[model samples]
Target: MSEQTPALSLPLIQPSQAQKHVTHNEALMRLDALVQAVVLTRDSTSPPADPVAGECHIVPSAAVGTWSGQDHALAYFDGTAWQFLTARPGWRVYVLSDLQTVIWDGTAWAGEATSLQNLSGVGIGTNSDSTNRLAVAAEASLLSHAGAGHQLKINKSVATDTASLLFQTGWSGRAEMGTAGDDAFAIKVSADGAVWNTALSFDPASGFASGEAVQSGPADVTPGRLMRTDYGYGPGNVLGVVSENAGIPTGAVIERGSTANGDYIRFADGTQMCQFNATLAYISAGLCSAAWSYPMIFASGSMPNVQGTLDSDSLALTAPSVTVAGVTGLTVSGLGSTNVTLNVNTLAGASFGSGESVDLRVLAIGRWF
Candidate 1:
């Protein structure tokens, strides 16, 4: 037969003992100070100057005055003297100063419900479902950083999985943005929550964006889309080697090349031009003929309009004669897309003497596509 309670150390009356009333009364006093006990504070390191009867306090570490060497003990003042109770592990006490319940864990006291880790669900002002394990029904939710910066990341299990933020109106989705159904980022919109329209998308590897909302008109009436190198474009771009295409009144910026035959330029709108310069000797008085080949061939079945001009000193002077002959007329015959024949006539019906030459500049314009 033990003489004290195992849990609270409450004294028990001994059988066949003298003065049983004294032992019973001591047990009662102990019970009065302990059952449903409360302490004034756990922060006081010294005894109160004037403590009333039944008043108690949980003595903290390094206690001074009459409480020296009584750290972590429940100090109870019973009328004429003080009684100290040794708190055991898992003992709970209502702290009046802190207005909360604290529990002893052999070492120190701490709030009863401060640590809530590994909870399956948590709801604030709402009920949490299985899918939405942590639901917060509030006007706004803020996730701020502790020191520097913050990032809200939504990750998916696989590339084909969706991870996005959806904006809603009256519980109906209206807009969404993120990687949906694939790795590429996409922005989609819905009017009635039934039919969805992909307004924009970005490639994951190249980051190139594409959408039907991209404008393709010539005027600056709307926003524009990114231009592809192969797409047809109007003037005012870089000059490069590009294939010809049709669709607008404007043409390519400039697609040009040079070769032994002649230099040629083509545009997106099928416009082509060729320039060439050559020297010829007169076959007879007042006439000379030569064939001109284009550097680049034009579209088939297209005849180019040709024009020519003679250099200032193109008509050579006769060896013995000092008079200089000038060009009078120039004509193009046997017109073709790739080549043409040019004829030149000099003023005063002058002819180039033997071993003499005249310079001719020619221009031809037509279609290339």
Candidate 2:
């Protein structure tokens, strides 16, 4: 026998003719212990005290007793003693403790797939079928990192590709939001899935929002920004207001007063046309009566044109110094864009006595521009 030959080599060696059978029998016993191997346990570091013959186990690191230096090796018992074999990479064995198969890499054992074909159905914590391929029944599930931050990302192949989250009611689409058929982000809703309406959109290049109102801050928005609301004007459904205040700008405006019969339009230059009426107590030669003032200030000190009617209030035919008449003539003067002066004069072209009075009514129309 060659001194360099192992006792378990394929070609058996014997020291002499008498020991040849003994060597062959030993090799046969080693084979019988290892072929079609199934490990009894894979987690323990200590050897079993009463292992059955032909039983095998995987040795763990830092092992004690007879397995002390045989880390990651297979321990096979041949009825009387233990035998250790260094496992090669890719060797597989069924683990009785775990009811699974494990494969040996160069350094350790790892799980191996037991089946390779497709199956009709599979479930995790719940039942699944053809329509819903995967299902999980749990309060919550977490996808987290072992050492660093984690992120969940959805991607599309191109700019025009649709990547969106569709919200549904009973599997009927109700809303969707994302980059739909383009790079711009959009939020769309549908009464029925077939007819969709865009509720909001954002332009990537302009950084502007459209199709809806955009607001900043909780209550007091920043100055110079605009917030929108539905004005309920029937066709023009939206209107904008200054974010911080509601002062009207200096420009043309169509406005209404307490009476809803008509509207008045005023221009920035102080031009106006309005239906106005008033009654004035006039004693001829009395101090001019003040009636109304313009709503806006004029750029220049210009008076508005005036026209109106006059009516008599007293029925007396004559007073101490002046004769009372059936009707009195009314006129307006000192007409400023800021204020108008009303006066009543007798039809006989004379100033009336101090005790007499008349009523004045008018329609004023002019421009401050």
Candidate 3:
């Protein structure tokens, strides 16, 4: 390991007599120059602080944001561990939930919508309000039917003042009012409507309720045909039916006479004239020669269809001779002249012959159907 190198001759000073060295700054400057040749500093002239307690270091606030191991990326300082905040993301403001997997509102978490609907579709049972009541599907009744009972059907739109449930054992399985005969069962009400009763009335023409009894007459009584029978009177056999529909309270009408009590006659305006009869017949002429205030339309609605007849028993005819026009039955005279010469029984098509020589011939032709 010892290799001897040649050195030029120099004056050898002994250790006891070394001369004093005076250049301290000159050596420091030379050491700095050598350090700058390897690692350059922005301010290499400034001296570093002591490594044990570094209070003398001064760095810009921006420089503290960076670091690199032992030497900070920027300036380093007293007891502070360097954090590179400017190079990384900032702190988060919003909160998140791991369990709910929703963005937290801090107060509560919100979710996405699932259902929305219109009024028609959101009704109780039926989608629309027109159907029956929306009840529990196939549920039992509030009061189960122990024996034979009825069920009430309800409407669907029972929101406000809806009606109560209507119950009916509706119609029974059997038919009513059989065709054998008229049982004559009828709904009868009291004078006041507070009470109603099922009553029966025997009809004579129906032969003990065998058929229907028209309020007009018995079966033998034909329209425009006069029959005399005492319902409950001595001379009340003088009964007759007009060919027109008449009042049930009133017997058949007859436009037979003239002046006031007449048959088949009309007021200035044509209405119907009739006699209401029960215990006794009361002659109330609606359509007469005079004006009737309230006029009713005849069932036929026309003059030719209006039917009437004359009977010598019901009417006291007092005329000598009256001429009836062929179809019109219009009499030229004889308003009211009672003599012993009037004959009411006559054949069809010629109730009275047209005679210009006569003053009046009990004329009645409006009775022709």
Residues 195-295, model 2: lDDT tens digits: 99777888989866765334442342545434533211222322222111133232223332323222234543244555545545544553224465544
On residues 1-369, what C-alpha lDDT tens digit does candidate 1 reach at each position?
999999878888888999999888778877887889898899999898889988999999999988899999999888777788899998899999999999999999888976679778899989988888998999999999988999999999999899999988998999999998899899898999888888788899999776555444443235445554334353445576545324443434678888998788887567889998876555665557788888888779889888888655435342211124445556878889888888876567445455555567888999887
Ranking by lDDT: 1, 2, 3
Model 3: per-residue Cα lDDT over 1-369, one tens digit each = 212112211123334543513133333332332221212222222324332222222122233223223121112222343211111111111112212222223332234233664323333333434453233333443656767986755343423333332222332222222112333332232333334222323443553421222223533454433332321112332234333224221233333333332323432212344321111111121101111111222333223222223333332222222323212321122222121122123223433323212112132221122
> How much lDDT does each candidate structure score?
0.78, 0.63, 0.27
Per-candidate clash tally: 1, 0, 17
**Would you give me the overall lDDT of model 3?**
0.27
Model 3 CA deviation exceeding 4 Å by range: 1-111, 114-356, 361-369
Q: How far is candidate 1 from the true structure (C-alpha RMSD, Å)?
A: 5.0
Better of 1 and 2 by lDDT: 1
